[model samples]
Target: MTFGGLPTRWEPTGESRGVALVAPGRAYSPAAPLLEFSRRALLQHGFTVQQLWWDSTTRGEDEEPEQWVRRHVEAAHAEEEADHVLVVGKSLGTRAASYAAERGLDAIWLTPLLVDPVLAEGIAANAGRQLLVGGLVDELWDSAIARELSDNGCDVLEIADADHSMGTDDAVRTAEIHLEVARAVEAFLSQI
Candidate 1:
């Protein structure tokens, strides 16, 4: 499926209170465990979800990576009619942080690339409530940065021993981690 010239999967809920624009990572799709559960949580909270799909192949020849991502995110956002908007992004999808900040839209960034100055700055600039989920073991995640953002009032959830996928090598523990994240997402939505 495609919306606003980009591949998309839309799930509309009854009497939706808002819209959640889900931006997937470089490899993770909306159907992945983390994003899928997050999507379900959003639906349970009365949000209509629109998941954007893209990859390196989707980028134009002359376009910068960040610009490509922002363009797609903004285009999807423009198509929404809801006054309330929430952006749910994972890893590379966190590139939408700046766009969300500019719009003052609420957001949930999973495994955000905190090492990138631009991305970190964008997350900091967001005026709306934001939840940042990252693992201590993930190279892209910086504990100091997350703490700094938390100090600035953004909600932060740092899972120890979990990797970039927010999972450990132990299957059972990984599943439990997923449950923990799902619960966190639910709690965050409740506050919003």
Candidate 2:
């Protein structure tokens, strides 16, 4: 299908609980491990998931990232189930945090850019049930903001010795963190 003139892949289930928009970080496609995990988890929870293909080639240097993302999300939401949208954004895609806040949608932010004041504030202001997972060592990951978001009822997972890629020296530990994130997403979806 097409969304906002960009390509899209729709994975809809028969008995969906809601809609889930899997926003991929610029580095990867919706098939990226992080986004794939989120899509699978949402599918397991009976959500109709739409994986958007963000056309980086069309992005203008002077364009506002928030508006760019919001336009696409809004376009997709118009056709599918959207009463309970779960916006899952990672890395650069985290710029869409404010879009979620504006729409009052639940979200799962992986390695979100807490360094961006506007993005961070959007994550904080969004009243939807949110799962914010970031590594303590990642430059973009701010422990203080994570703590604040946690204090404000957002489920925050601060991984020690991990970096922006959710990786550490130990491969086993990294795998465990990955599982933990998926489980947290499942739990959050259940609650939502």
Candidate 3:
């Protein structure tokens, strides 16, 4: 159902240790298996999940996803009583890095567009705990920036031969990578 103009899916675990705000990519769905796996992992770790799914086709060129994320996150955080807030963003969703940083919220950026000068600034300016996960094969993935972030204490996960979606042509390896991704996210959440 929609929450405050945002197409939101909120899964509340009876007793929560924290809240996880999930943001999908421009073309990605919140129901994607990787995100679903993250939800399950979060739930298992005593966290509630709030997923925001957006349709890029309907958005105008002037539309800024960072604004959507900032608005919704502020509203959601106000409504939630959870002590810890964690933001999980994928691809386009990573544009909210600056906003998330401004709010002092920890974030996990999946396949972040680090090559974009505008987006890279967000990551650079962010002081919050940031976890960056990307594949070496993805053209937009900037290892240099990721290395810098890693050196500065951001958690980094680099999957070999994986594409933008962290997927490989080999089904078996893809499945293994998916599990690895889920486990890494889980590990990151535990620290926050």
TM-score of each: 0.93, 0.89, 0.87
Tens-place lDDT digits, model 1, residues 1-192: 774565455565578899999998988887899999998999899998899877657677998767888998899988989999999999989998999999999999999999998999999999999999999999999999999999998999999988999999999999988998999999999999
Any runs in candidate 1 off by more than 4 Å, and if so which?
Answer: 1-13
Q: In terms of lDDT, which candidate is stronger, 2 or 3?
A: 2
Q: Which residue pairs in model 3 clash with each other?
A: none
Question: Candidate 3 on 1-192: residue-level lDDT in tens?
Answer: 674575455555577878888877877777776788887877888878888766666655776766765665567667778788878888887877877777778888889998987777777777788889999999989999889889887899998788998899999998988888898988987787
Query: Per-residue lDDT for 62-132 in model 2, tens only?
Result: 87877787777677677775567788888877777888888878899999989889899999999888999
* Candidate order (lDDT): 1, 2, 3
The local lDDT score (0 to 100) that residue 176 gets in candidate 2 is 86
Candidate lDDT values, in order: 0.90, 0.82, 0.80
Comparing 1 and 3 by lDDT, which wins? 1
On TM-score, the leading prediction is 1
Q: Candidate 2: where are CA atoms >4 Å away? A: 2-13
C-alpha positional error of residue 118 in candidate 2 after TM-score superposition, expressed in Å:
0.2
Once superposed on the true structure, which residue ranges of model 3 sit more than 4 Å away at CA?
A: 2-14, 68-81
For lDDT, candidate 1 versus 2, the one ahead is 1
Q: How well does candidate 1 match the true structure in TM-score terms?
A: 0.93
The positional error of residue 1 in candidate 2, measured at the CA in angstroms, is 3.7
